[model samples]
Target: MATTSFGAMRGLLNVKFFQTNFSAMEHRSDIKKDNKMKEFQRILKSLYENLIMLELYPRSQIDLQVFVLESDGSYKSAAFNAVSLALMNAGIAMKDYLVATTSGLINNVAVLDLIYTEEKKQNCEFVMACFSQSKNIAYLSLNCNKINAKDFKNLVEMSQGSCDQISQ
Candidate 1:
């Protein structure tokens, strides 16, 4: 995954995996404002271990390169959708389709796939990636300001309705 920032314009992006032998993740944020690299690594590990059928191939690496072009909203979610399709297109085996979305718990109401402006106005951000068939979370990331951790699960579930759309 990656993000670019120049003066005021900012973007977020990512790549994904398929059934392969080697796995590596790289993310660069020139602006150094948000540490998305850390989140990227976590997602990478989950994808590699949970979805990819690594046992099929040995001593090979499937170098997936993630790049950020332009983004005004939840690019990570878009990236996941793109990567999953790429993996499918490449004939890589996966357990299921992975769908993702970014939303916000604003004014006690959970919102769906939020844009940058809407995301910023809220006190928290929710990022989620899951299996379309299982509804199991393959990856989850959150950015919060003055919010309760206990409420995170419910908030995430509330936004699941949005993620379901992309999974299809």
Candidate 2:
């Protein structure tokens, strides 16, 4: 779940993550201590910083609170898509629609939207976000080591196609 609010503050934006008792996969009570959660927060913040028209809200900040209800593969990409929708619903001005998706390489083949099981079996996974209209990448994360240039290109292409489909 994501809740976004525009408020008068010093920073341009702030993102926070919370996990409820129902979040079975999260063992920590304090989200700040969880490195993965902190990383996600940072990633989400960067993804929106450039897309949002911050100049319009001078001396204000956009607060985004994301709740992790479950642990699943491709959650990072899911969060980006969720926040984008929330901002749009709130009538926030943006340069373009942000679309994100996860793709992985299994047996040297590029695959899209891997479930938890498939994600573990992947040789590498790519989390990518791009503007739907411009098709310019806003963020990219590769979760593994040692993917050849050709295979990396294939995964990027596959991820872009997946993002396009999700945008549609």
Candidate 3:
């Protein structure tokens, strides 16, 4: 679903996404010109900033190139996983494995790793990433019209469980 390359270059943390068509169709351009793509890039960069030990490489830059070959729903999570593994492979210093997952309430039931269709069917959605070893949250985003406390709690639990599974 995703592949990434990690390099030490000249800027801080620079992340670029390629094959826009495969990830999500957008206007044909040499670079991703869509607002959604830019937002995705920002979110991914923030996620990396949270997990990576940036202080260790003060003068060096961390360059990550992510190519998304396919996506249904939760492609950002795939990107997170890809970059995390690539960082480890490249021997970059990281606090921990940043495992991510998307979960939502479908008919008031917690569901994990929803597909495109399942995403539409869900009432509320949450994207979360955490330090797998420490079980500490690194990032969390929510999108829901309205949800009760019980349902929200269940969704968080489900999301964390899925992240743990992915980490393994």
Candidate 4:
């Protein structure tokens, strides 16, 4: 699950556990204990993968549950917001907060958080991921057209502003 808000990322994180097989008892044939265990194992495996990433900023374990409040062109931003909020809600310590945004050049206009319609018309695409707390860029990728130095700088600035808004 994921969530999005216009403000800082600290407000959306929550952790929860739910019974996946809650209704299985009503359908006895579907309530296989082994199957449930397997599902749990898969979840654990995913958790392990996340843990490996979290280890880089280790402090505490995070258990969070998020729900999307809205959908827009910035799904990655929303997901990052959700994760950051979840960690904060769980009281996990970290060196920095990460934020992400998508951008593209459409009809020669550089646009931030391009909507689906804009993306369809765009000739170039990019996503910028940054660490807001540290003011450091973590990732940048261009999909089609090459961004020259000037345009790259503008994109970075725009993305940084988006990150600042998210981290605040």
Candidate 5:
């Protein structure tokens, strides 16, 4: 029997920008923005290095999966949000593409991306997968019972928005 094991790593980005009354008069906003940009760059750099290392494995093929434990609006969309940036940093070639995003139906309304609270109240949940570069859907999975065809179509459209933002 041949066994294949998958290894996973988790990364966190907790950035806090506090404003003191005294410093608010100064360049506090500018300072905070600069720090945020630096943090974003660091995250992209780390993800790129990790993906590159995964490519070094001798396996004939490898699958990279990313999960977002915390999200405000674009939960699934945020999962691989940094992946393209990382891939660009590492200079990896991809025949196809990978994109992910979350959707929820709340109060009979289909929302593109739901925060934690909205997700709690929603009756339906969906995760849409697509090609990162070509903007083609690969798969869609719905939780909290099955959804109708119309709702499914809406989910695809909303999820596509997420993919488009990431591609740019």
Candidate 6:
């Protein structure tokens, strides 16, 4: 994905075919198909829509699958990065590189690229996925345990910074 580390987190990315039931003459199934995809699978569709030249392959189907070989924490971030690379390896067109990272606020202390143990101890958790060049978030998921407003703000900033660092 973004980085290879001795860190326990591990990820895998795979691509599969897209399936939809619409008349070839209609050519309007993409919208409907998206509505039916699972949240995780739908994420791949979003990335394809945002970055790929889908018009180049009209009526074509492309699907992506991501697996966590192992995990310590930040699995979502790793999965995003892995899929980006898989797209590149397939010679697919792209707007830019995609990268991601995770952060957690534990004991009022902010930590970057959290490990599983650290995540288990956190007051809040944050994850972000964004384009490296555009720096626009494709996805963000945050969970808090009664975290204060100020701390929540700081966590967002910290997560953004971590996401940027991975992109670089």
State each model's CA lDDT, in order. 0.64, 0.81, 0.78, 0.57, 0.56, 0.67
lDDT of 2 by residue, 1-168 (tens): 122434333237888976555554435556544777788788778878878877677667778999968756787788889899999999988888788999998888888887777887899999999899988898899988898899989988888888888888
**Tens-digit lDDT string for candidate 3 (137-163):** 888888999988888888888888888
Better of 4 and 6 by lDDT: 6
**lDDT tens readout by residue for model 6, 29-113:** 5667445335656666556566765444443555676654456667667777887888889987777877888887888987888
Order by TM-score, highest first: 2, 3, 1, 6, 4, 5
- Taking the tens digit of each residue's C-alpha lDDT, what string does model 4 give over 1-168? 222342432323224422333422233234574464355345433432333344333333344543334343454455555565656676666666567788888766789887766777887877776776677776566777566777777777887888778667
TM-score of each: 0.70, 0.82, 0.79, 0.56, 0.53, 0.69
lDDT of 5 by residue, 71-160 (tens): 354433454554554455655554544667788899778887677678778989887767666676665667877678888777778778
Model 1 pairs in collision: 22-60, 22-61
Off by over 4 Å in 6: 1-38
Model 1 misplaced regions, further than 4 Å: 1-35, 38-42, 148-154
- The local distance difference test score of model 1 is 0.64
Over 4 Å off, model 5: 1-75
Error of 5 at 47 (Å): 16
Candidate 3: C-alpha lDDT: 0.78
Candidate 4 lDDT trough over 10 residues, lowest sum: 9-18
Superposed Cα deviation of residue 67, candidate 4 (Å): 8.4
Ten residues in a row with the worst lDDT in model 3?
1-10
Of candidate 2, the 10-residue stretch with the lowest lDDT total is: 1-10
Which structure among the candidates has the greatest TM-score?
Answer: 2
